[model samples]
Structures are given as C-alpha cells and as structure tokens.
Target: MSATHALRSRLRALALTAGLIAAGAAAAQTGSGYFRYGDARLSLAHAIAVIEEPSDQADERRTLVFLSAQPLDAAAVAAAFDAMDAVREQAPAGGYVRLCIAADGSECGLFYSPEGFNSGGYGDLALQRNEAARIAGRWQLAEGDFLGTPYDFDLRFDTPIAPAPGSALPAGGGAPGAAYNAWLEALAKGDVAALRRMGGEDARGRFPEDDAGTVKESLKSLRDGEPLQARIARGRQHGDQAVLWVEGVDRDDIRRRGRVLMRRTAAGWQHAESDLSSVDE
Candidate 1:
C-alpha cells in the first residue's frame, strides 16, 4: 500500500481500539453499582430517596421512583436485594419489607426497603391483598448507600393507607372535621365569607376573601396537568389542638404525592405551612 493509504489504515485501527476501550468502561459503570442487604444485592436502577423523612403521614409531594434502565423483573429485584444485603452486612442497620401476594403467595414481591416502599408515597401503598399492614424485615448496612433503617422492626401502621382515592380517616379527626367541611363548602360554592370567618386570628387573618376566591377558582381549573387534587385523608387530635392532613394526590404517577398540614382552630381548622421534604438511601 502507498504511505498515505497505510497511514489512514493505521489511524482507523487506532480509533477502533479506543472505541472498544470506551465501550468496556461504559459497561463497567453500568454494572459497577449495587447496594446490598445482607447477601442480597440491589442493583442501582433507580431509587426512592427518603434520607431523613418521616415514613408516616401521606402527602402529595411526588415520590421519586428510580427507574431501572431495564424493566424491573423478579431476577433483577433479587439482584437488587443482594446488593442491599451487601450493604446490610456492614453498619448492620435494620430495615423492613411489605410484600403482597395472591390468596396463595404463588406470586410474591421481593422484600423492599421501607424507604423504597414509602418514598414519594402519599397515604399508604397497600402491598397486601387483604390490605395488611407492614411486615418487618431486618438487615444491616455499613456506610453503604441507604438512609436510617428502622430500629424496632415493628410495623407501626395500623390501617396503612394507600395512595388511591378514598377517605381513610384515622381513629379521631372529628375535631377538624367541621373545619374541613367549611373548607369544602367554601371551595364548592366559592364562598369568600366563610373563608374570612375561618381565617387565622393574625393581621392577615387566615386566608383573605379575595385570596380564597382566587384559590377556589384556580382549583376548579386544577385538572389540567395538576400535581395535586387536594382531599382530606385523615387527622389526629392533640387536646384542643388537632392536625388534619390534606393529601396532595398526584394525578400523573398514580402512586406518589405529599401532605399539607391543617390545624384545628377556634373557628375550625386553619391552613398551615406544608412540611415538604425528602431524602436519599
């Protein structure tokens, strides 16, 4: 071959070798990541990050579901658990899982981290067919990639509310029920007078009439790609004070959302600041 032709061929060969080396590195990065629970490995497909978040209380904040590059299968799920186990064998943290199956567990779910299960979740995400509460599992991880695992290994959820559309009131929420009703009426009819009456006793009162009316009008139009369709989920009483949670239902994900706090007042329940936060593990 001529010198020019030989030089071109050598350059092409060099480029090919470089491309192969790059491809190998990409593959290593793809499979290099994994979190372990005991001996179980959890491949880092995607994660539901909730580092310092309280597991209870459903809200409308979107739960971030980490999507695996590949569709999650039973085998991949098992691999992911293996990764989780690898981490757990260390720091020796405590974690739990909630699995559901048919009448017979012919089909069963791989044990999932509570963070994974509850991340970005509003209300309860029922994993059991009978709507059973959580089933605790134990695993320990070192300085691995996980948030604080539960300690007691106790299932704190009594009725474990899922993020579907329904009114799952807690044992005692009547204290705030009146206030919630007032809100419903005010919103339904765009009643600014009721808003003024229920406003907080501060300089700004609670919600101004104009603001309330504007809010109602906006909510009436919330169906167009709205993140939350506010609804009363449940509440608890603290003597004269009570806290009612309004679920911000995610119309898109169909599985994630956050919570907003509504506290009982002399007139009724007054809207309060939202506790919106998240984590990673």
Candidate 2:
C-alpha cells in the first residue's frame, strides 16, 4: 500500500476510537455506576463522597457531590447542594451536615461535627440516618460529616417536633411548658421538693425512698451549681411523649450544650432520655 494511504487509514482509526471514548465518558457520567437498593439509589460519585476519608496528602481535600436516584444534570445537583449549603450556613460553624434523599419526602441524614480531630459529637450520624429512614413522608438529603466517612448519613427534612399537651403537671407552676420552665428554675435554685413534686408518681417511683440516697446524691450534684442555666431552644411533641430541646451553659464553660429531655406520661412533664448523653463531654 502507498505510504500516504497507510497514514490516512491510521488517522481514520484514531478518529473512530476517540468518538467511542467520548461516548463512554458521557454514559459513565449519566448513570454508569449507581447502586440500587430497592427504590433507593446511591450514585458512584455519592458512594465515594460518603465513604471518602482524609488523606495524608495535603491536596486530598474533600468536595460535596449531590447525586439523585435518577439521572440529574450538574445544574440540578448544584441547586440541591445550594439548598444544603443554606442549611449549613444556618447551622453553627465548625460542624458537618450530611445530605441524602430518603424514600419518604422527609429529609434524612446527619448534621453534626466534633470540636477537633474529626470528633463524633452530637446528632450521632448513624442513629440519625436510621431514625430518619423510619419516619413516614419523603426525606430530603443533606451533608453531615467531616472527612465524611465513618458515617455516610443522608439529608432529611426536619420533622416538626412539639411537646405533648397536658403531659406535665403544674407543680408550683402553670402549664406543661410553664411547669417545665419552673422545674428548671427550681432545679437551678436547688429546690428539691419542687423538682420531686414535678417528677410526679413515675419519677417518684423511680426515685423511691430505697433509692433516695443515691438519687439525692446524683440530683444534688447535678443541681448544685446554678443548674446549668438551660433554656428551651426548641420543642417537639409526638403523642403522649415530647422532647424539650434545650441549650445550656455548663459550669465547665462549654458555652452552649445541646440537651434534650424526653417527656412521657409520668404524671407530669417528667424527665426522660437525654440527647446530651450521646455526645462526648
């Protein structure tokens, strides 16, 4: 064959290969490696985003990648991330937020960050993601993690949390909210009788005479120093139970500590589980 002819044939082959490669790239970006678990789908980029960790190399910085269950454009993902960024802006600085869309319309995921060294602090990511999945309604996603791994949480909408009405008794106070406020006030004042009274029958049973010594010791220790000066930041109610989300300045000068008191049908607005316990002190 002529040398010129041979050169022309090589050029043609190169062009064809280049076209194929371009098409493959587009396909991969669209939906090449998205993982599907029933109606829920996680994209390859998103999976990588969630599992990615900090690297020794300085240039190994992490970036947010928003993936949809179905095909989405860069613009669509960017818009979602923008909304998440807004939420992040509203959140206190030095924290992480996880963004993921759950099967339900409600948002699901983690939104917390430790003080330093990738600490796993408030709003435990794993637990939040699991709980978000359980609730009904669609869940929107959010970003929530530093180094973003060790917990691959997805974003979900904030479920309206309210306190159960008539649940808390008026012990030297008014309504449930008022009583809770009074309880905290009494607790701050070291008013044991008032605190005990607010405890109602259930709290009393839990703090009976047999266990009074230990209970008193514990309660006294907690009530000793200005009662932590807590304020109700928010409240959420679910049937007979409710959660009084509080922010308190601890004696240790931790500034504001996120605390939660779970109130159930225990004769009054009695203390239940505490979310603060989930964090590292």
Q: Who wins the TM-score comparison?
A: 2
Q: Output the lDDT of residue 265, model 1.
A: 62
lDDT by candidate, in order shown: 0.37, 0.40
Cα lDDT for residue 66, candidate 2: 32
Q: How much lDDT does candidate 1 score?
A: 0.37
What is the C-alpha lDDT profile of model 2 across 39-149, one tens digit per residue?
333432211122111221223222332333332233322222133443344443333333343333222332333222222332322213223112112122233334533
Locate the minimum summed-lDDT window of 10 residues in model 2. 46-55
Candidate 2 Cα errors over 4 Å, as ranges: 1-176, 200-202, 210-212, 224-227, 251-254, 262-266, 277-281
lDDT by residue (19-66, candidate 1, tens digit) is 999976543211112334435544432222111112244232221122
Model 1 RMSD in angstroms: 20.1
